[model samples]
Target: MTQRQPRRAYDEQGREIPPPTLADLRAEGDRTAFVHCDATGCGHEATISTDQFPAEMPFPDIALPLRCAACGSKEVGVMRDVVGIYARPRERTGWGMT
Candidate 1:
């Protein structure tokens, strides 16, 4: 199968919404969203970075236009990404220390 490239999604208002990428989202402090297949027997999941999708649209509405890429099913579940209250500690390499 050919690799699927990210496609520019559009909002109902005809605005071009850029597809989410983890790096871009993290740099801009944007919230990430997840899309999972809700099909009874389908086990598919994907993570996407987003913030107020399609021109600042809200939840449920933002999820409305999404379709499952795995099973080609419209029965999918969407939710915001969750992060733990505490982040992992980084090692003290002391490389940049003067």
Candidate 2:
């Protein structure tokens, strides 16, 4: 028989709400990445695929298009660097501290 592990939860502050399991991570279409705006007070959430965004582009720091979903403005500017699989911490280190 196999033992089932408990799921983990996290708060907005990144505090561990609970311990997560392999299944938990696999939920929601294998959710692997998260995205948010760089602007202050803007707490938008966007999910991206690990395969689509190669692990080469700087993630959590890449300069992607910044358009407001609420207002729909093209005049939008890069509020903050976006986050993704390509922007993983290891990738950043591999660049040899740019």
Q: For each candidate, what is the lDDT?
A: 0.57, 0.41
* Location of the lowest summed lDDT over 10 successive residues in candidate 2: 76-85
Tens digits of per-residue lDDT, candidate 1, 13-71, equal 76666655544545544456767888889968887655446544544344567788888
Return the top candidate by lDDT.
1
Residue 80 error, candidate 2, Å: 15
Candidate 2 lDDT by residue in tens digits, 1-98: 33332223456775655533324433422335454544566655555443444344433322244455654443323222234333546654476323
In every candidate, how many clashes are there?
Answer: 0, 7
Q: In model 2, which runs have C-alpha deviations exceeding 4 angstroms? A: 1-31, 61-98
TM-score of candidate 1 versus the correct structure, residues matched by position:
0.49
lDDT of 1 at 91: 43
Among all windows of 10 consecutive residues in model 1, the one with the lowest summed lDDT is 84-93
- TM agreement with the true structure for every prediction: 0.49, 0.28
